[model samples]
Target: MQALTRPYGALHCRVDGPSDAPAVIFANSLGTDLRLWDPVLPLLPHTLRYIRYDKQGHGLSTLGGGTDISDHADDAIALIESLADKPVFFVGLSIGGLIAQTVASRRPDLVRAVVLSNTAARLGTVESWQARIEAVVGHGLEHIADAVMERWFAPAFRAKPELALWRNMLTRTPAAGYIAACRALSKADQSAATAALRLPALAIAGDTDGASPAELVEATAALIPGATFHIVPGTGHLPCVENPTAYAAILSPFLKAHAHD
Candidate 1:
């Protein structure tokens, strides 16, 4: 485990693969930790050093205050710049995707390429996000856990016993962390910046994803020039968990192609 301490708090991260390998960092969705990419790491090209971390307020990381997507992006950039020996390939999902974009735009030299999964430049209406924040603050994470689960996993996947693990993870997430992230999302609208990025990029969508539908994910891809887009059939928002093979099939080639570019 590798850790980086910031003025506000510290981030807990894990790195695997050869030390001399190219770096590929993954940022997970809201309510999930670095483990979100566990299924996909083993399937990635062994030539890459895969890195995953628990962002602020999730997993083992501290829940800091007064941060937006850019600050989250900076934390990722700081982690990579301090640890990685070379430029990194970044992959992010949902809110993580927003952070990925901010990273690319603000620090293009540190990033070689990026893959945006199940996310968009702009999410739901601000009012809807505020309602969600209020619900979580007023009631508890349990209040919105089920509805979020519906957006996260397909019905078939939900029926399986494995869903309980994710549900537990969701409900266990710190309320302050979840609410702060929601407020950040409510204010995020990265259309122009995302559209302006010039890099190797791919956008992934789960066919059954309700939160970030295929069209929404594709739209983000369309923002970047030469970006490739794909859809993972049968999976929902968090496709990396449901079908790691499918997610890796698309990502491995991108990493290989852009490893040196």
Candidate 2:
């Protein structure tokens, strides 16, 4: 684990692989930390450097209250800029995808390419996000973690041992942080920004993902010219954990093909 002070707050990050290798940064979804990427990292070839960091309020990172996606994107760019001069392959899931899109749009020079997984350009109805915020703040993370876990994984995967582990992690996250993220997602609208991105991009979705349905993923892919779209079989929102091998099979090629040399 490594720590860095960015403009927004202190960021806790995990660096893997060779320092000199082409950089690939993985951003975690709302309510989860960089640990979510643990299963996918080992499957990736060692030729590239990997950076996984907790978003503000998610893991070890801390920030002032009411941080939005744009703020989060700035934090991400700051972290990457502090680490490497080279552009990086930005891999993001769910809310992370929203941040990646924001970064690519505002600071295209920092992004070599993007891998957006199990995410949407615009997530949830306003009412839904509001309800989510209320639920988390009123009841706590554990109150909604079970439902979140169900949405995160397919029915079959819910019975797996790792599902329990993920649930525990989700349940223990700070309710304030989770609610803050819900508000961020509530207001985030990247449709115009994402459509303008000309960088090489890949959008991966799970066939069973209720949060980001295949159609929505397909629509998002269509917005970006030449964006490759792949649907992971028998998985839900968190395909990186639900089906790590298959997720890697799709992601490794995307990373290799567009890696900054």
> How many clashes in each candidate?
0, 0
Residue-level lDDT of model 2, residues 23-126, one tens digit each, is 98888998899999988889998899999998888778885453578878877888789886699999999999998999999999999999888887898877
Candidate 2 error regions (>4 Å)? none
Clashing pairs in 2: none
Worst 10 residues of 2 by lDDT: 62-71
> Pairing residues by index, what is the TM-score of model 1?
0.98
lDDT of 1 by residue, 217-251 (tens): 99989999999999999999999999999999988
Per-model TM against the reference: 0.98, 0.97
Q: Per-residue lDDT for 111 in model 2?
A: 94
Taking every candidate in turn, the Cα RMSD to the unseen true structure, in Å, is 1.0, 1.2
